[model samples]
Target chain A: MADTESLLTTPLDSLHRSLGARMVPFAGYAMPVQYPAGILAEHLHTRAQAGLFDVSHMGQAEILGDGAAAALERVTPADVQGLKPGRQRYGLLTTEAGGIFDDFMVANLGDRLFLVANASRKAEDFALIAAALPAGVTLQPLPDRALLALQGPGAAAALGGLAPALTALSFMGVAAAEIAGVPVLASRSGYTGEDGWEISCPAEQAETLAKTLLAQPGVAPAGLGARDSLRLEAGLCLYGSDIDETTSPVEAALIWTLGKRRRMAWDFPGAERVREELANGPQRLRVGLKPEGRQPARGHTPIHAPGGAQIGEITSGGFGPSLGGPMAMGYVAREHAADGTALELLVRGKPLPARVAPMPFIPHRYAR
Target chain B: MSELRFTKDHEWVRADGDAATIGITDHAQNALGDVVFVELPEVGREVTAGEAIAVVESVKAASDVYAPIAGTITEVNSALTEDPGLINREPTGEGWFFKIEPKDPAEIAALLDDAAYAAFVESLA
Candidate 1:
């Protein structure tokens, strides 16, 4: 942990404190980890209702000019040039070695491409994107904007009351809208695998916007604690934990993000490894793990085969509040990655029973 | 009659003669938030003061529950294995982790009493 004095504060810092949030240092910012309601209640609430998360620490930027999309394709594998206006697509910034540098969301906003990168990697991501961009295109960081995610089964309903036009936006749809007369850009997408929206507004209006959203019925404030559990249950890869510079898209089971045209062109960074992996599967693959007991197998727990041979390591593991049991995700040998393959998780010097299970420990209720 | 004492680590001991019942304090449980599992020390196991004898896990992370005084474990809380939430519901009562036969009953005198512990918790805030 860094010094508390050196940590940055989000636009909603005082709002979180006012709501009794337990703030902790995350990605250099003092962010809320949980509130008075605790992680369990917050996790369950997000599943049953709506959770408003202040994700301002994440990096927001815009790539402008006619060839912006094409320029972005130089470093990423997503079909950014084909993204329709008012639509967003998940993208992975690949290293020259075909490993994931960072995972981000790129939204096509007609004249420009808007990107949301993980906070921890935002600085490096923006620099890499800028350096890769062609002469005409330019990267513009949005330092004065704040991002908030409203996620859950009831997200649309809660947010719909404020901006009814948001309800008409399909999944991954982005649009300029107004909530309580505040100008904002909202997308019908979230990381929680729920029907929801991620709204970006001016930093000054963040507190007011968050308060307004929380005022909605069945909408409550959740912190990073709930956010993490929800994403894990949704089987989403966390940037630093699940996928990193050492992990390739294929090994992370994110081949779907690789566009067909990009694969054929082999123009993106690390295209050779990705191409080779596509032709012949990667040596190890990421898989979901379901422990047989209540004890969770936290991150870095060694994974072993039935015969005691170490197969891989757990990247993200914890008690899935929605699953009401322990759930985890890790990389394993291709042969042991099959669903229902029995495995052992070495926890506290003892081998705990676990198995490879299909991810999304619970069903995703996305409004596709 | 049992006399209650508290450790700076937030564990409480109810001393009845040479027998001592131990559990985490309500403040500790509140900070932990929603206990999901507990790993108790084995019965008859000898432990020294300040040694981590058990583990208590919440949804977010796991923490060690230290032994506040030297003693031999006499009994373990088996019920907690089935209902770990008991720690959140009754942290000092039915949520007791274990009982021990104290190696030195005089150690209880050095532990904080109710008022002193209350002040200690206040200072932390």
Candidate 2:
């Protein structure tokens, strides 16, 4: 962990503190990991109602150039060229060697492409994209902006008044709107497997926007701890932990993000291995593990076949508050990736029986 | 004559003659956030002072519950298996992990009392 003194602070820094949040050093920022309500309550609340999260530490940027989309397509596997204005698509910046450098969201904002990449990889992503740009393309990082996510079944009800138009946006829809008179780029999307909106606004007005949303019925301030459990139950990948430079998209079961046209063109970085693996199937694939016991098989725990031979390793694991049981995701040999295949996770040097289960342990409640 | 004592590791020992009831301190449970599971030592298992005797898992991470003083396990808290959140709700009461027959009840005097344990928890902050 980086020294807290040197960590960056978001516009909601004082608000989080005032709300009695437990501050932790995360991705070079002094961010709240959980509020006084606690992670379990926050996770359960979001599933049942609404939860607000301060995600300002993530890198926000805009790509400007007549051929910006085409240029971006060269670095990422997602179909940037086909991304229509006011719509967002999940993206992956893959390495030449077929491993994922980072996963991000690319939204077409009419004149430019709005990008939100992981904060831990923001600096590296900017440099990578900048260096790959063809002549005339420019990338601008929005250091002066802050991002917040209002998520859950009750999200629309809570945010309808603040940003009237936001409640109508479909999943993955993006629009520029005013909330409490503050201009914001609100998107109908979130990491949690629930209906929600991610609102990007100028840093100066973030606190007001957050407070306005929190004042709504059923809206409560949540932090990173609940965020992690929510995403895990959603079966979404967490960069660096669940997916990284050493893992390929095919292996991570994220081949769906690869554009159909791009698959034929095979022109993006790492396209060869990605294409081959997509056709032939990877030797190992990421799968969800339902551990038989309550003890969570956390990251780096060795996974094995019934006979005690190592098959793979757990990348992310924890207690699923919604499921009321311990669940995990990890890479297992293709043979063991089939749902219901019996596997064992070595926790505390003891092999605990686990079974490969279909992901999204809890069904996603995203609004279509 | 039962008395409460604490260890540097944040476990509490309620000594009554040669037997003691043990549980993690409120301070420890608070630091651990939501307790999801508790793995207790089996009854009749002998454990040395400061040894890792049980395990407590929270949403964030799993932690070892150490023996505050040398003792033999006499009874384990079966209630925690069904409801581990008891640790967070009542760390000093219903959340007690197990009972042990201490090898030396005299060692209770060596552990921190209420005032000293409060100061110890303050030092951490």
Candidate 3:
């Protein structure tokens, strides 16, 4: 609820306003929360067709110098050292205690490593990463760039005409290509579980590229409201809400991000503790929840056993528009993390029946 | 049409002798945005004016719907149970939350009239 006067504006600011988007301050930027179509319609539209998003607020940077990937490995547990060129990997920056500081995507652009971190945590993540860099490596923030995501089932068909090379790219693949005469680094990856692409380009060319994408058939402009719901249904973690400095990667069900080589070396930050947890398992685990009714049990709702023992708490909860029911994700005791286990959510002091369900509540449709 | 009255919380009530029907105003539904679920009080339940009597859930958040006047619940709208979007479509007609038997029919005049409610909504902007 801070004053909009102090907020930063992205390259698509005027375009968003002209399209009747409801602008809200997010991560210090005046961003659109929803358009005139509303959140529900925007959400369902993205699942069935295609949705365009202006993600220019996210931080873009490059890791340069000799042994850049090896230097990054000091702070993150991902296999940055062995990452193939033109490939992208999802990773986490961990605290000394093995707690995740931020989640990021790193694309090996052949010559330099292209890194993208969360909007709010970019500053902190960069500072931590910079301090951990060895003598030859340097992190340069890309302040002159902009980011956008084109997502859904119809996204490929809409964009494939401009760049035929895009059709060959697999999920998590990255390539530097020219789309409609604009040079861009298009990564076949997105926060939503749908098959999609996130394009990084110069700030000056952002509005032009976005306009071109929106003109494509079946592609409509979507905002952060639909983006949040889409990612939640995909069971993707929102940095501050779902995972934070107090939650370790293992506890948050992100062990898949730790490469086999990284685990064997056990030399990254908080490696001792992370290795111990990897072998023995964490005391608590993050799991998906399906509330047994139409009523949504929102974040901070307490989870209780049948007789009423506080076991865990809901971190992210809302109505999944595509599924036509309320869904939630939370952390509970490992023993209670099994799918189909009975649980209850305390909503307005009333116990609402819920069950532990498998995630990506709607199965991911990402390209293999 | 029965005489309509409004509450400060944006609920509107139409009172016809002892029976009254209640629902959130058009302004209320527009502000809430895309209602997905509605939970109303049980029929025959007694309620006081200004008490939280029902819940309206939207894609953005859940809001409590307060009773406009003291009454005993009579009938609830069953159409909203399957499709809550009616609140966004026809908030004053098909979207009526529930009906009740007023404890005192005279209380209806004390609430805001149509003109007064329009002025109140304008003042908020």
Candidate 4:
């Protein structure tokens, strides 16, 4: 962790403080981990209603010039050129060896391709993308913008109250609209596996916009703690915790994000490893785990077969507030990745009974 | 009921004759929000002062509950296995983690009293 004094503050930093948030250093930014409501309440609130999150720490940028989508395809396995305007797609930048560089959301906003990358990897992601670009293409970093995610069952209703036109967008749909009289780009998608919008606006208008969203019925402030638990429950992967430079798309169970055409073309970086894994099957696979007991098996906990050798290790594990129990996701040998395959999680030197379970412990409520 | 004594680690010990009821202080519970699991020490196990005797888990992370004074565990709280939130709801009462028969009751006097513990908690902020 970096020194607190040297950490950057988001546009909503003062607002988070005013809301009684517990500020923590995350990805070199002073972000709120939770507020007075705590993680459990905030998580339940989002499930039942809506949560407003300050995701301004994430990097937002645009790709400009002709053949931008094709240029992006050189690095990522996603079918960027096939993405139509007014829509978005999840993409992964792959290392030469097929490991994931970073996972990001790329939206076609008609004139240019918009991207949102993880905060920790933004600098690296931008530089990598910029260096890979053709002489005619350009990468534009949007440092003057702030992003917010309004997510939950009630999210659409609350945001719809401000800009009714946004309600028309389906899941993964992107549109440019004036939300609360502020020009913004919003997508009908979120990491929480809920019906919501990821809205991007000018940095200066972020506070007013956040307050406006909070003023809407059933919308309350949530912090990174809730956001993390929510995503975990949704079976989504956290970049640093679940997937990293060494985890390939196949092993991470992100085969769907590997565009069909790209797989056929086999032209992206690290294509050989992905192709080999696709045909021969990955040695280890990311799977969900449900501990029979209440104690959570946190990240790095060794995983083993019953009365057998160590197979893999837990990547991310914690209490899933929605499930009202402990849930986890980890990589295990392909033989033990099936749902209901009994396993043991070595927690605190004790082997705890657990079983491989299907992900999205709770059903997703995305507005598709 | 005897007045509660405290340790700098935020554990409280309520001494009653040779037996003492132990639990985390309210300040500690507030710091560790939304307790989800409590791993209690086994009865009859001998513990030394400042030793980690139990584990308390919240949604975010797990913390060790240290022994305030040396003692032998006489009984453990079984209710916490089912409802760990008792630690947050009643840190000093129903949330008691265990009862220990002290090796030396006089050791309780060296721990912080209520007012001193309160001041110590304030200084942390």
iRMS, all models: 0.8, 0.7, 0.8, 0.6
Estimate the Cα RMSD of every predicted model relative to the unseen true structure.
1.3, 1.1, 1.6, 1.1
Extract clashing residue pairs from model 4.
Answer: none
Worst 10 residues of 3 chain A by lDDT: A159-168
Instruction: Give a tens-digit lDDT track for model 4, residues A237-328.
Output: 99998999999999999999989999889999999999999899999999999999799989999999997899999999999998999999
TM-score of 4: 0.98
Question: Which of the CAPRI classes, incorrect, acceptable, medium or high, describes model 2?
Answer: high
Q: What would the per-residue lDDT of candidate 1 be over residues A219-279, giving only the tens digit for each residue?
A: 9999999999999999999999999999999999999999999988999999999889878
Native A-B contact fraction in model 3: 0.42
Candidate number achieving the greatest lDDT relative to the actual structure: 4
Best by DockQ: 4
C-alpha TM-scores of all predictions: 0.98, 0.99, 0.96, 0.98
lDDT of 3 at B26: 97
User: Interface RMSD (Å) of model 4?
Assistant: 0.6
Once fitted onto the true fold, the runs of candidate 4 whose alpha carbons sit more than 4 angstroms away are: none
Better of 1 and 4 by TM-score: 4
Candidate 2 per-residue lDDT over residues A1-368, each given as its tens digit: 35789989999999999999999999989999999899999999999999999999999999998999999988899999998999999989999999999999999999999999999999999999999899899999999999999999999988887777887889999999998878999899999999999999999999989999999999999999999999999999999999999999999999899999999889999999998898898999999999997888899999999966999999999999999999999999998899999988988887899999999999998888
Chain B structural similarity (TM-score) per candidate: 0.97, 0.96, 0.96, 0.97
- DockQ: which is higher, 1 or 3? 1
Task: Tell me the deviation in Å of residue A327 in model 4.
Answer: 0.4
lDDT of 2 by residue, B1-125 (tens): 47689999999989766689999999999999999988898898989998998999999899999988887899999999999999999999999999989888888779999999999888877
lDDT of each: 0.93, 0.93, 0.91, 0.94
